[model samples]
Target: MLRPDDRGVLYGEGVFETVWIRDGVARLRDAHLARMARSAALLEITLPDPAPLVDEAEARWRADGEGALRLVCTAGPAGGEPVLYATVTPVPEAVIAQRADGVRVVTAEAGVSRERPGWSLTTAKTLSYAANLAARRSAGDRDMLWVSTEGYALESPTAGLVWLSDGVLHGVAGDGVLPSVTVAHLLSEAGGVHGEATVADLDRSDGIWLVSALRGLAEVIELDGRGRARSPWTGRLSRIVSRRPG
Candidate 1:
């Protein structure tokens, strides 16, 4: 039970991880836990042993067949042990549709620069997502691609950006963006580069995708009202990412 006085309820002091489950197994479970642990450390929340939590999530997966498992850790009532829990739910149909049909995206100013201080929380997957949700609402249907105040492409409200140019796969990299496990896995399998990108760079790229845990990869078919030719690599890359890793 969550108390009103808990720091997570009162001030969003928490971290979370959403894992994609298939065939009674959680995909990238170790990577997700590692990232969650790092985020909890950054927030000064003591993380509980995740073995029991993983067992709970696995039980849900065994029951549901396919779904998303969300594990959360919150700073429980100040001066007390942190609250940890996990929940499982079906993956949204819309997210699945986006993977098949792709998505149209709009670029928006993020109002922040890429140069963040060492203490910045931008890289942490915390519970404070009001700003990101607000930006998505303002996009009004299409997904919003957040660009830094310096005009460099950062990421989407809920996903990471990856593009291909001259047969080279590239991922967005900077202090302002959250590290994406999905993107990292894809890059490791496909081989890629990590660097800063501008809107113009993406505009001319061979392909673009918004990668996430639940959604996997959604191609960007249109951007700011301009339509792009579907890339031949989309199908091949999708197959690469869909394979179950050992």
Candidate 2:
């Protein structure tokens, strides 16, 4: 149980990692942990040793089962020790469906300036997610693509954005967007470029995808009511990222 004064509970001061578990093993475990550590450091929260929690997650996973594992570290009650915990749960069916079928997206103003000073936490996976969740809720049936006040495409509420233009892969980059582990892995396997994007650029792309740990890659069939032609590269790229690391 959490204390009333815990900073995470009282002020949303925390960091977390959501790992995709496949066949009882956490996929990209090291990457997730490294990101979490970075997030913790940004918040000045000392992360506890993760080995015990990782072992516990491994023990809970069934031989051939799949799940989502969450590891959380939070600022403890006032000046107390930082709190840490882990949980494993089934991956939502909707996430799996989106991975196979694809998703529709709508771009919206993020309401925050990407160039704002002292906002280094923008790229961290911190627990202050109310704004992100609200953006998704506002999008309703379609997922939301957060854009800067200047019309530059940033990223989605939960996933990173990647697109194919003239047969080359590209991703949204800079301090404004969260550095996506899934996108990095995909791009490392299949060469890609990283730079700023605009709605017009996305509209003219050969294909667009929302990349994440849980969703893998969801092709964008439609964007802002405009239909996009399916790219032949989707299947080939998906196969590349789906391969388990040796």
Candidate 3:
């Protein structure tokens, strides 16, 4: 729980990870732990060992099985020790439906500053999610595609973009974007195309997907009012991610 004066509550001095649990096992456990450690290090926060957390999650999974699991670490109140906790939540029915049927998305010029300003925690999964949440709200029921000021596709609020073109699987370079673990794993299996993407480039792609931990892989079926037929690879990719590492 957060105190009124906790740094995470007051200043968002925290990081969190969302993982998928299936058959009493947490998928991508190592990758999520590594990313949390990196984010904590970047924020100069001392993170506790994650082994116990993983063990506890596994125990919970054994009791209840599949669900969404969240791990949160906070810098705590001034001069206080850091706080850590884990929670499980039901995976929303809508998310499951979208994963099966794909999502209809709309692009919005988000004016994201890729320069990684001094105050920018872009590379870290920090607790300050106001901007990300707001952008999604602005989409008015449709998922929002974040674009940089220069017309490059950055990412969605909670997922990374991976598109296929000319038999090449293209992923937006991690430089100005969050280094998405899901996308990285997929690229390792399917090979990768390293580059930036504009709206037009995305339009010309053979397939496009929004990848995340919980959602796994969701194909983009429509964008900005234009409809795109579901790609033949969507089901295959979904199957691959459903068998996610445990």
Candidate 4:
């Protein structure tokens, strides 16, 4: 286990990946590691060898039966005593069920400014997730939208914001702080993924859903506390991918 005194705990330094593990296998292991490596580089943190981490995950998966995996990499202890820690947690049935029904998401966006230097932390999965937690809490009335100050639809605390326009899958495009592996795979497999959409496009639509690795995809029955059932496409998409548990 990673210590509370580790650099991640102390300075909230280092990147992490919440990779999903199910059926005795880990999904998108390569993409997650690649993102981690990219994030670590942006932070100028030295990443430990990936082989050991891979071995650890495989061993733990075989030992613990299997579920979802949380991979965390920090700067380690003050003097470099702590190393990266990996843990496995069983995937909650509720998560899958919610995905089945589709999760509602409040529109949220990340603000990148000259002072904030978006490149510094926008892409890295740092432990300083207080803002995200706050975004979740700030999601008052359950349907609140947390869009960018500029009104661009960024993403949700736990899910990527995916919308459909003219039968096309349009998602937000940027550094991909969106945690878009599932969507990425969806677009790659299904084809025709358009990024760089505006919140106006989403609002003009019939509905929207919050997306994530765990929840997969959940529909937004409402937006900004408004009661709206959403388009039939939500159920259709959910069902279309039901047979394949990607």
Which one wins on lDDT? 1
Q: Compose the digit string of candidate 1's lDDT tens values, residues 104-160.
A: 999999988999988899999999989999998999989999999999999998999
Model 3 TM-score (2 dp): 0.95
Candidate 4: tens digits of C-alpha lDDT, residues 1-246: 677788877888877777766555566778878877877777777877665766567666754443667777788877774366677777787777776554444555555421345555765667788877887787754534455656567666666667777777666665435456766765555454756556667767765766666676688776654556667777666654332345
Off by over 4 Å in 2: none
User: Model 3, poorest ten-residue lDDT window?
Assistant: 58-67
Pitting candidate 2 against candidate 3, the one with the higher lDDT is 2
Superposed model 4: Cα runs more than 4 Å off: 1-5, 55-66, 78-82, 108-119, 140-145, 175-179, 239-246
RMSD to the true structure for each prediction, in A, is 1.2, 1.2, 1.6, 3.4
Instruction: Give each model a TM-score.
Output: 0.97, 0.96, 0.95, 0.82
- Give residue 10's error in model 4 in angstroms: 0.9
Residue-wise C-alpha lDDT for candidate 2, range 1-246, written one tens digit per residue: 578899999888999888888877788888989989988988888999886898789888885766888888889998699989998988899998987788999999887776867746887898899998998999998999988998888899999999988888998875567789988888878889887778999998888999988888899999998988888888987887667767
lDDT of 4: 0.65
How much is the lDDT of residue 143 in candidate 3? 87
Residue-wise C-alpha lDDT for candidate 3, range 84-162, written one tens digit per residue: 9988877777787778888888998877655667656788888989998998888887888888888889899999999
Which pairs of residues collide in candidate 1? none
Q: What is the C-alpha local distance difference test score of each model?
A: 0.88, 0.86, 0.84, 0.65
